[model samples]
Target: MSTLLLSQDQVKELFTMKDIVEICEKTFQGFGEGTVINPTKVNLDLGETAAFPPYKGFMNAMPAYIGWTDIAGIKWAGGNLGERKRLGLPYVTSLIMLIDPKVGNFIAVMDGAFITNMRTGAQTAVALKYIFNNGSSEKKPIKLGLYGAGMQGHTQTLAISELFDIEEVRVYDVMKAAAEKYKKDMKDVVKGEIVVCDTPKEAAKGDAIVCVTQSKDKFLLDKWVKPGTVIFPMGSYQECDDAMLMNADKIIVDHIGQCLHRGALAELSEQGKITEDDIFGTIGELAAGKLSVGDYSDGKIVCIPIGTGAMDIAVASIAYKKAKEKGIGGTYSFV
Candidate 1:
């Protein structure tokens, strides 16, 4: 027996944003139905010195088993915002190891950064399918507000474009150049106007708002968020003000436990401002046909996705199979 090795570019080539969204939808549905085991990721914090001061980074071990796919995998995912950014590299880097369910042997290892970015965006798409569109195939014109014009921002735009007719996309980054780059790069990708905003407030005025920044402090204020907007904060630290949580008409998460551990609402959870009960429901539940967001259409909504290992596994498993069938990757024999 041998294990196949797939590179990041190879993995990216194996799936499109649409393919990823579909896979993530199935994964979430199965997760909500209790057909998947997604454990809380274990984080190993490397204090501020790992990067520049005030910007600590971490590595996490995320493991999961998708019963429907009959595959088990673990992703070694980590990032250092300051250090990597200083070197002009991606803030996050990851590798996934896939295991055969029956033999308990490692079968493949693949680059996980692409999977991570696409799956994270796909997660929001899945949530929108049920929460915003109510699981309908009909597309609506959407104006999207985005904070942090980075890779995730790009992917988020691509994923959302698959489901909605993007009427406009407003983007803001601390660096004006970054926002301009996003506009230039995405102008052709999104069949809509891509506006580079001068301020976060300007960017926050759309149908839906997405924050993918690495800010340790809050930049997205509650006042900036208009009513009838869905906010997706995908960073590890809190980007939105506590009022965004306290005043949101409904708060949905990919996983409740993960929401408490890290991501947008972790501090609020730690401070007892909100608890699991405060959450309306998980995206998985909504995707599973157990809950609906139709009642909250006119109100402000927030969906916090920490990104799950099952999603990584689902995409990775399929990539591995495709690699083997096409003889695309190098293999290391173990027998």
Candidate 2:
């Protein structure tokens, strides 16, 4: 048998954010219906070192199977934030291995960074589609507030723009240059106006707020969040305070177990400030038609997406297929 090998550039050509969003919808639906098997990711901590200090490094092993698609895969992903500044390397690096579930043989291997960011952003888009009742047809333009102007930040705007008519995007970062760069880079990417804020609070007043920062500290105060606003905290660490979850009318997570392990609510769960009961349900339930947001026009919702292996496999499988059809990837015999 030959295994398909796809580089990052090849993977990017195989799919778009629109494609990812659609697949994510189906993937989450399958997850909710118990048609998908996504194990909780196992994390390996890499303690702080002088070489990778301040950021601390870690690796994650994420494995999943999509029964409907008949494919299985695992993602070996890791990141070192401090190394990015020191060594001019990417903060996150990942590779995905697609397997034929029947024979348990590797079918393809591909770069996962693009897939990671796109799917992570697409997850939020999927959540908003079901959680928020408002649509672009309402003629009420969306004002998006963002904390952390990085890769995920860019993709979040891209994904949300496909669902809402964004009139403005207010972004805040500790680095003024980064926020300014985001505004300039996203000017044409998003039809909305991009504003760089001096403070996190300035960016929190919006129709929807998203946090994709690397800050280990809590920056999003509950007081700054307005009513009827939906918050998406996509980072691994806690960005918003406990009240953000405590006072929220609805709290939907990508995976309940993963959320407790390392995402937005991890710290809260560890401290006994919040429990599984506090969570409304997984976004999968909403996607699968098992639950609905139901007239939440006046409610505050927090959707925490910690990233999922099922999504990675779903997207990777499509990319592999597309590459095969287009004759775009290298093949190596594994005899």
Candidate 3:
């Protein structure tokens, strides 16, 4: 069989946020029940070395075998720290490969950067589904708070809007221009007001706050986060400070193993401030009813979904299928 090759633009044409979220729910639910096969992601830090410069960024290899669809694949992605500074490129750049489980043949090649961002955003939506109301549904107008305005931030906003009726979006970025641009661009798409805030504290005052920055230092402080707020820290690390994790009443993660190794809660785990016991459970558990997503009505909660490979492949699988059905993407035979 010939393989399908999909570009970023083609994937975008075939991908739907609502469908992506639904597809993610099945994979995530299976993962919680120990049915889906998703190994802990591998990370390579290329810092301060002869082969690479220091503090730029590293690469990650995330592979998964999603049972529901019977597709196995891996996402080979990396961050080029110098590109943003010297070449005006985003730190992240990557692609994904989808294989046919029946024949063990490589079946597709697709741009992973967009897939990654969309899945990451969908995870946040999925987390909110489980954590927002104990696996129930919410219909109230959402007051959204944001900490970053880059590509990830934009996609997160897009995904959340698909799930909730966001009446207002309060955002803050270190670069004022980025924040302004995010608002200007979102105005036409966002039904509600997109307000720019001067500080992270101002941005954190929403019912649902999402932090999707490349921050190496913690910018969000606990003093700004009020009770009954649900925080989604999407950055790999150090977007929400230690105080939030320490003070949160309940903590939910997409994958406990992955989050412990890196991402929002890794530093907190390393510092001994937060432990495995403190974690409530994976978002999937909450969705699958295996673990309790008790009411956070009177308490503060945090969800850190450190981007799982299963979700990545799940979305890619959808793109591949849709592209095939719609006669999209290029065809190649390497057999």
How high is each candidate's TM-score? 0.95, 0.94, 0.93
User: What local lDDT score does residue 174 receive in model 3, on the 0 to 100 scale?
Assistant: 95
- Candidate 1, residue 258: Cα displacement in angstroms equals 0.9
Error of 2 at 254 (Å): 0.8
Candidates 1 and 2 compared by lDDT, better number:
1
lDDT of 1 by residue, 1-335 (tens): 88899999888778889998998999999988999899999988775334424555678899999887799999999897667879888888899999999999999999999999999888887888887788887888888899988899899988988888888988999999989999998887778898888987898888789899888888899987778889898888889888888999999998888888798888888889899989999988988999887766568999988888999999999898888888788888776
- Model 1 scores what on Cα lDDT? 0.87
In model 3, state the lDDT of residue 154. Answer: 82
Error of 3 at 258 (Å): 1.0
Model 3 scores a C-alpha lDDT of: 0.83
What CA RMSD would you report for each candidate? 1.9, 2.4, 2.0
In TM-score terms, which candidate is top?
1
Candidate 3 per-residue lDDT over residues 30-143, each given as its tens digit? 888877788888988766122655766677899999888889999988776664558877677888999998889999999998888788878887777777755656654678
Rank the models by TM-score, top first.
Answer: 1, 2, 3
Count of backbone collisions within predicted model 3: 1
Error of 2 at 189 (Å): 3.1
Please report, as a residue range, the 10-residue window in candidate 2 with the lowest summed lDDT: 133-142
Q: What shift in Å separates residue 273 of candidate 1 from its native position after superposition?
A: 1.3
Model 1 residue 262 distance off true place after TM-score fit, in angstroms:
0.2
